[model samples]
Target: MTIEPLLKYMSNYIDLTSDEVVFLESKITVRKYLKGQYIVQQGDICKFSCFVLSGCTKTFYMDGEGQEHILMFSIEDWWTSDMGSFITQTPADFNIQCLENSELVMFSYDIIEDLYREIPKLERFFRQIIEKAFVASQKRIVRNFSLSAKDQYLYFRDQYPLIEQRIPQYMIASYLGITKEFLSKIKSQLILEQ
Candidate 1:
């Protein structure tokens, strides 16, 4: 795996100097994970911030009755980590599971402080990333309250056009906060309307 994709992604937010690049190269590690592998399990401390080089993963939490509620899906070029756990070095409330064979570029929590100090622009980049994620989360919450189930499915389809094909229908149902049968009915209604 190469860090080129990561460099390109970073460049979108901040131009990296050669020295910064070299430092990052030395600190980052690339790892491969197979489908069904757990990158970060609930109750485990998340030591790494993972960036998807290829493939997809789901970040989720289980309820008291053991029903999984998917919070988000991370695909190529997206970042995935249990932010609360990674930042505080506490046990994670969420689980990150690979949905496909994946390659990830990871940065350890141990060196992140050093990286921020050495590369000041890196802090701005992460701040912006966090801001965007926060905004998206807020919007999702609003949508869940304001939209109907059919509208929610449509919105999800428009937002992640390729994700429907990549993952299972039941997984999408879970993400949509609906039963698989309801999702199927909504989909059928859409098809008939079309």
Candidate 2:
């Protein structure tokens, strides 16, 4: 099993002994999802927190009108899950889907709690991760309210330049909370300025 990516991620927060690494490897289940596959669907209980080893995934919600609003994107080395659902063991409000064929390391909530008990450092590591995620989410909310559409597009472009080539423009537009046509106009203006 290829667990190098997960191990590398954990190393940032805590130093794991070989035995701990082995224990982690035994607990995690590696899975692959094809592009367009749904890892967690709206209204279904989210059972696992997943780390993306490769490829991309998007967490999004569909409105009653059937429009998608992307909440977050996860690429290699990133973690993605419906946190509330995973923690509370309730149905998810959003869907997590793969944008490309993806490899993921998944830990069930029970296993994760057990790990936290067995290795307290892992709890701190996850707590730090959640803290960062919360901060980022807050920043995004602020940006959506305060930033201009062009500024939002530019911010996203600067932060995730490679994402444009990986996913469709409409998805990017949705993520930016702008119309696809408006995003195209922004892109055109940017090109003209360049």
Candidate 3:
């Protein structure tokens, strides 16, 4: 399926002409992954930057005690990748896994680099994407620090209502920095109050 969201995302930053869209479409490859599969594993040099078409994926890393602490989640219309690795051509510290069956439009780093070199407009697009991503990441960190577990859960649920339906409960808990049992308790408490 064509990624209409990609066009929309590009449009938000820079207007793409019909000819530019056609050229961009030619460089993008649609990829699919099954649930529990990794889109990119830790230590592999990232080759592509992916835009999620459907489903949920997480970026996380195992900590000293081997807990999988989440960095971010990508749902429909969001992009997923270890962008640092993708750009630097180095081993990724984060593992990106599909939480459910997912479709993505992937742009090869090399090809896109070529595109940016030849068509400078693509650089502006990427720069804008990265700038926004940095801001969002900063906000997430601030929220995680300030919000209580229940508040965080509530906020995340409201922010990505579709994400809850698409991803497993345990993964959601992991993303929220809580145990599955804690999440269950929170849900039960919420129900009781309601």
Candidate 4:
């Protein structure tokens, strides 16, 4: 895949001049990763912020009991990075793993400041992206506390219809904070109700 997808996605937020685009192309790196490969692992400092040109990835952390709690899933045009680690240059608490053979456009944190300096709107574009992600995260937290498991599952299905088909049910259950069997039962009940 090419950086065209990323450039196009960015256009939805901010227009880039030809010179800015050329500068971006010079600083950006594109890489391919096979399924199950990790782009960032827990405890390692996240050096790059990546945008998916194609395919999917999961960001999660393993608990003390070795249970994995998925934070989010990112597909095409989505951004993935441990923001805390990337911004602070600290060890990451999450691992980002490819769920399919993926192509990503990565911007190194080292060059981000310079990019922002040269392309001021680029910083605004990222700010908006982060703002949307933050709002979604806060909404998810509220949903977890306020909604029943079945309602949460329904909401998830409605919000991520594309994702529901691509990801395994068990992983979806894990993301919903419900057991797989419980998720199965919920799906069955929904079908029966229909």
Candidate 5:
């Protein structure tokens, strides 16, 4: 692959010179995974911060009963990592698995720190990205408390249009914190309303 998507993403926050782009490209390693492959397994150290060039992955936790709870989904152009584990070089609390055949560009911890020191503008870019992730997470928490299940599903649909088609229904149900049967009922009601 091409690093254009990453370059474009960076350009939104800061102007990158040709030399800087080359330097960034040198630090990134591309890898591909089949659907169902685990990028980061729970209890393992997450070695890389992954940027999705194509396809999707989900970060999730497994409860004592072995129920999977989705924490977040990273689609094309999005980044995914166990930030705590990656930064601290500790075991991860979550699992990251590919939901589709995916291509990712990975940056190791050392590479990121080097980038920060070499191109300080990247510090601002990452800071903004982290801030936005935090805000989105906070908004999700607020919506979980404030919105009804059906409304929450609707909001998810609006927020991630076409995502429903890409992933399994049960995964969507899990993400919305609802039973699959409840999600079906909601879909039926929406169909009737339409």
Candidate 6:
């Protein structure tokens, strides 16, 4: 994986000095997880923010029936964490798991906070990322409520095309708020029409 993309992405928000970049990079721990491995589990406080360098992860919440509803997918360059737990230092209500063998640049809460203080530009960069994420979540929620399941799946694939190829159909169905059976039927129908 190229650090160039990540550095460029960060540059879009804030200018980083060489020393600051080096310092931030020094604090990051490169880690890997196998598919189906839990990155953050329910009841565990999220102490770190994981930045995906490659592979996919799913954030999901389990229901009383033991069914999981996927809230989001994190792919290359995306950040994954149980936000509530990270921000509040409380037990997580959701789980984040690797959908594929993955590598990430992980930063602990303390490290991030320390880096932010040392590099004021980093704080600005994080604020920008957070704002963008918030807006995207708002738009996603609106689409989920207003769009049909098939439409939602289609749009999600269109938006995150790489995610479609990397993640499982069942998990994609969960993210779309539809049953696996229903999603399979829809896929079959679409293929037949094509």
Candidate 3 per-residue lDDT over residues 1-194, each given as its tens digit? 68798788777778877887788888779988999999888889888899888888899998779889788889888989999999899999899999889999998988898779766898998888889999988998999999999999999889889878877788889988899999999999999999
Candidate 6 Cα misplacement greater than 4 A, ranges:
1-3
Q: Give the winner by lDDT: 2 or 5.
A: 2
The residue pairs found clashing in candidate 2 are none
Q: Which model is ahead, 2 or 6, in terms of TM-score?
A: 2
Quality of model 1 by C-alpha lDDT: 0.94
1-194: candidate 5 lDDT, tens digit per residue: 69788888878889998999888888889999999999999999999999899999999999989999998889988999998899899999999999999999999999999999999999899889989988998999999999999999999899898677788889999999999999999999999999
Clashes of each: 0, 0, 0, 0, 0, 0
Error of 5 at 28 (Å): 1.2
Tell me each candidate's TM-score: 0.98, 0.98, 0.91, 0.98, 0.97, 0.93
TM-score of predicted model 6?
Answer: 0.93
| Lowest summed lDDT window (length 10), candidate 5 | 1-10
In the range 118-186, model 6's lDDT, one tens digit per residue, is 998888887788888889999999998899988897898789998888877898888898888999998
Give the range of the ten consecutive residues with the poorest summed lDDT in model 3. 162-171
Greater-lDDT candidate between 4 and 5: 4
Residue 122 in candidate 2, Cα distance off native in Å: 0.3
Model 1 lDDT tens row, 71-182: 9999999999999999999999999999999999998897777889999888899899989988999999999999999999999999998888899999999999999999
Off by over 4 Å in 4: none
In candidate 1 the C-alpha lDDT for residue 135 amounts to: 98
Compose the digit string of candidate 4's lDDT tens values, residues 1-102: 369989889989999999899998998899999999999999999999999998999999999999989889999989999999999999999999999999
Which regions of candidate 2 deviate over 4 angstroms? none
Better candidate by TM-score, 3 or 6: 6
The 0-to-1 C-alpha lDDT of every candidate, in the order given, reads: 0.94, 0.94, 0.87, 0.93, 0.92, 0.86
